[model samples]
Target: MSDESAENLIAVGVHVIVKKHNFSKVYKVSENGTLMLGKNQKVEMHEVVGKPFWSTFEMIPKRGPSKNTYSLRLVERTESLNDLSGLKGQLSGQDNRLIVDYGTSQGLSKDEILRLQEAGKSGKEIIGSLIENSTSFAAKTEYSQEKYIRKKERKYMRFLTVCRPTIVSLHEMYFRQYHEKIGGLRMDALAQILCYSDVQADGLHLLYDSGCQGLPAAAMLNRIGENTSGHLINLHPGNVPQTAIVQAMNFPQELRDRHVAVNIYSFLRLHYQGESSMLDNISTSSKKVTDHIVERSVEKLNGETKSDEVSRTDTDISELETDAGENSTLFLRDAEKDADTLKRKLHEFEEAEEAVPVKKPKWFLETQRALDLLNSSKVRGLTVIAKEHPLNIVNALLPFLGASRPFVIFHTYREPLQETFMELKQKRNAINMRLFTNFLRSYQVLPDRTHPDILMSDTGGYILTGYLVQE
Candidate 1:
């Protein structure tokens, strides 16, 4: 393979899409591993290595010598979908009055279907055979026939398409299978959070997120851009912030460093008590070590110079005692000046000693960095997406945001945001507050059959957006 081809080829540890039945999922390609789709459904992932993104492969079932045992082999780097466009040319009845529902509509039995699968018939061929064997397929309406074909395709087809993972694609996968994991945050809702909060490059944003798996923080970081100096301080309830989705983003180390994940407890504790309160112990110990070193150096310098000064002072005293006149008074004044100069020089020497740099822990450094921004009220925006009461979290973190900066709160329930909205209004801490939800409906576009999808999410959760006002 050429160098260019190797660069484009899929490698381990990078996220890739595993698509089946028009639904897609994001999975990191691992070496010599298998991807589990469900309890009994999985695909051997080794074949996807070195395959280019967006390439498609067919899964062929090879029968074992033992009864009822088989393994799948992926072959044919061809692109295809479960398209019923060929059936588009076929006639359709106006209604399904003539159609009858029966379990025996498909003429192929389980054993025959297994045999056909073992014969290495491709997914498309198997779907076509199933469609041909269905006695009632022709009698169904166009929409019904299309639905039937899709249903059969899902069961028989094993086409895997590898796609380059994106933020939006991964968000959709989380929303579908693990909605609660992301705190029921929808893609549209997340987009609104970004827009309302005005997340952009070179902006300092603060976020308190839990149950979202770090998706909100990741989205903000992506918007902040990789090459900019924007920073995100993510506060989570857990001891360690959730970073699964963030890792999936595959952000560069420089961009990842811009994000500071800290525990909410520690952050709030430091914030309320001041930095000095927490660092006092560390500082006291550090100061003790530094003072001990400085004191020893000063004592050694004094011992070397003080003995000679004392001997000179004794000899001068003996000579001055014999004189007892203006010369002695003059000598006393000179001695006072010399003593002052020595004290000044000793202080200077102590100040000149190079102190060893104290290396702080990573968490302490990150927390302190975030604290500096918060204490200065430099955060341009604040977003709260938590499973807990948004009221308490928002009330505690809202003051850290700069004046006129935007703030958004997301919750799975409307009541929490409503309550928060009322409280913010009562306190007059925010203006232009709007509590609303989004209704998203997907569509299935086809010739003379374009309509809203029969199934849709009723609500994408609620969001309360407003701008903070200085008190």
Candidate 2:
């Protein structure tokens, strides 16, 4: 073919010769346009398509006029082609022009294609990196791989760029799912289990697996020490495992001496038995103290009531009869006195309740810890946003709730649990319960509202949080 013709025929359906040395086995194009040959024989042909971005394509066999008709040669070329012949060669005889054009139309670039090849990375990785980097490209190519990596990676460092905010959003979405649908107990239990599972301790430092896509966990952990009271060291993902050991070793000797707590969350596991034991002791002691206080309060109230009943019964025989004879007047006086006494008693009880130091509910406390860890200097928070999930809601409010220190529960719209939130609200005293709904009007109308001790948000699937607001 003439050079001009060859140039013009660059479009699809062009015919070309195979470079013989590239393949050790001989193969020929079949009538169906697939490659066919002996198991041992091989040959290289010009790719009419492009590189395989995701999957590998295998050549198939076809029947022809000759007994050895497995092999065939192209006799002609077509016009309307583009210059993808070089890429076609690199992609093992696939249709380079077609693939390249498709990718280009989707916003990929030649340089990106090269980088993608050089990195030996998957399409998913390339796409993720591009989005995370927020590469600037033409509108069509904003999400296109070719425009982002080959062009953008040169200007931006993926690791140096900020991804924590987006990751944090995602984390919020996941927690929302947990809080709205899974219930607070399950959410706390899952977090605790994951945290404990990830813990790693050595003589020097403690390492833990903050969990997959850990930016959110790290952000939450950092916020714990700042917003609430806790001692936790947050670690970044890249420096983990090694940095964990270093931190574990270099942890403040003073804190250790004072029996202060040190919590670490990463992918590594804690190796020291002593540290694990310390954590267990703290958990056990706290639980014991709470139980004892509750038990004592119940006993004291019961004792007080029993004594009052005995005194009232003992005084009244003939006096009660005389009082009855002057019944109307005496009864009115006594009823008024009783009402006054009851009012006084109610006021006293309320004051005592207010004076009682409320322990934060487990979910709020744990979530606060996670938020503190996320905000720590050593770690950066990554928010994860999902379209729908309970975990997302929980993660989002975790910081706010921790600040407010409110009790939380999640109830769903379906099954035996249906309308359970409404029932609980009606049954509980107004002071003890507070509900926050997505319904905008309800949020606006409620007056005399103190910040909820228990803050609840719906997952659209269910309601979360019940009981006294902790803050």
Candidate 3:
């Protein structure tokens, strides 16, 4: 491959677009891995690893491990049907009167097709053979013949295109199949949110994403670019933020670090009050949930072997590190051992050694850093895309946004944004507030047959956008 082609090679572990016909999906390319496309059909990832994006590959039937079974191997397609227009020359009737609905239109049987597959017949070759054997081939019109060939090709002519995953491709995939997972957020709506919020490189932005599989954050990060001063605080409602799309984007570690995913509860408390306030809440929650917790006490025997002592020591260190954030004090586990024993030892150790440093939890440290950023008042914009009511969330986060900056709120339903519009208007908290929805229609432009697609989504959800002002 040339240097240009090498630049577009599909790398392993990054998401790749697998497309066939009108349906498309995203899959992580892995070494020596295969993806199942249809019943008894599969495509190997190794075939596309060094291939450029949008390269088409044909699935060739191969012999499986068991006798008389066939599998598929993806091979780079070197041939193209550039003269498909010539197919019109061989037609007779103008409509489907000549075409029969019987299953025996083609001469080949299932066993013969399997035999052809086992005989190493390419998809194109097999499709050609089927066309040759079809009794209705020359009886139908050119359009009918083309439609018949296409329908057959989709089934017998197994081919797929390898595409590089992008925001548009990934979002389309999610919107088509997993609409509920992304809060029914359409691409146009997401684009509007980014544009309305003015998410660009080299500024601090805030996102309160209650859901959408991290798509809102990923879009903002993509716009923010790499090696820039831009930073984003992605505040999610859950303890573990859903960042599948973010990871799928395969961004560099530097760009990924610029995005801080913190829990909304911890961030707000830490920013407005202090770390102690969040810690107190955490401690209370942990206490309430510790009732069914079983505490395992590790005891070292006097006659323990050297290997056993080393293993137990490692276990102790791991547990201590894991539990350090929950209970700040280091405990002498050898002398004291019980569930409540940990609590008692923690109190005694804290009383005796007040100068000792305690390790903060990972979430706590992240919340601290985000809190610092919030306190600096550098956040230029705020975006809220949530499954819950956006009113309360917008009200809580609007105060942190910089004056005269933009904020965009997105909800699947318009009524919630309508209520938010009313609430913000009453409070006089924002100006230029616009609550609106988007309609996205796709078109299929072909030679002499251009028209809009047969089906389209009636609503792409609603967005409420505005500029914030200091009271």
Q: Each model's TM-score, in the order given?
A: 0.74, 0.22, 0.80
lDDT of 2 by residue, 1-471 (tens): 676554433233332222221121112223335433335423223333322111122221223333322222232321111221211122122223333333334455658755664554533345444444332222322223343343433322111110112223333444444333222222333343323222222111111222333332333333232223333332323333222112212223443231112233221222224334444555567657755665675565556555754564577787756653465455456655665665576568557745764444443344344444444422211121122233433332233222222333333333323243455355442124333323321233334543533444433322334323332
Q: Write the per-residue lDDT of candidate 3 for residues 418-437, one digit (tens) a residue.
A: 99999989988689999888
Report lDDT (Cα) of residue 25, candidate 3.
Answer: 72
**Residue pairs with backbone atoms closer than 3 Å in model 1 (clashes):** none
Q: Please tell me which model should have the higher lDDT, number 1 or number 3.
A: 1
lDDT of 2: 0.33
Q: Comparing 1 and 2 by TM-score, which wins?
A: 1
Off by over 4 Å in 1: 1-8, 62-95, 98-102, 274-362, 373-377
Per-residue lDDT of model 1, residues 96-136, tens digit only: 99777878899999999888877877666777788788778
Error of 3 at 452 (Å): 1.9
Candidate 2, which ten residues in sequence have the lowest lDDT sum?
157-166
**Each model's lDDT:** 0.78, 0.33, 0.77
Candidate 3, position 375, lDDT: 77
Please list the residue runs of candidate 2 whose C-alpha ends up more than 4 Å from where it truly belongs after superposition.
1-406, 411-418, 422-471
TM-score of model 2 (CA atoms): 0.22
Winning candidate number (TM-score)? 3
In model 2, how large is the Cα lDDT of residue 349? 59
